[model samples]
Target: MRTIMVKVKPNASEAKIISENGNELVVAVAAPAENNKNPLMRVFEL
Candidate 1:
């Protein structure tokens, strides 16, 4: 398995991977941070 660093932005208009550089990524999710159980998992799913 490979390891990657993810930065999550909750409550976005859509879910997507915004930027990726090497092992780091910036992710945006539509679900609200408070309501969503696992935003990081959601990001991974996307």
Candidate 2:
């Protein structure tokens, strides 16, 4: 199994992840916290 580290930003207008020079990742998701949705779903969308 492989793990990629990512920083998550919840409730954004869009869902996406940006690489930061291979050292870090920035993740944004459209799903709000009130919906019982997990931000990790953003990765599945990729």
Candidate 3:
């Protein structure tokens, strides 16, 4: 799994993590409050 240090800050609504497709930041999914520590891991689908 991989992690992305989003420029957006945490605890700021899930909408903060936008997707960059075609250089355009689009709304992806609504992730719940993830109270995780450093070195996060992300599992992508497709």
**Candidate topping lDDT:** 1
Local distance difference test, candidate 3 = 0.42
Distance from true location, Cα of 36 in model 2, Å: 5.8
> Model 1, 1-46: lDDT tens per residue?
3334454556777767777766556655576778766656433322
lDDT of each: 0.58, 0.49, 0.42
What's model 1's lDDT at 39? 50
Task: Give the number of the best model, judged by TM-score.
Answer: 1
The worst-scoring run of ten residues by lDDT in candidate 1 lies at: 37-46
- Residue pairs in collision within model 3: 2-42
User: Which window of 10 residues has the lowest lDDT sum in candidate 2?
Assistant: 37-46
Error of 1 at 36 (Å): 9.4
- Model 3: per-residue Cα lDDT over 1-46, one tens digit each: 2333334233545545565554344333333346533333344433
TM-score (C-alpha, index-matched) for candidate 1: 0.39
All predictions: root-mean-square deviation over Cα?
4.8, 5.3, 6.6
lDDT of 2 by residue, 1-46 (tens): 2334443455667766654444445555455667635545323212
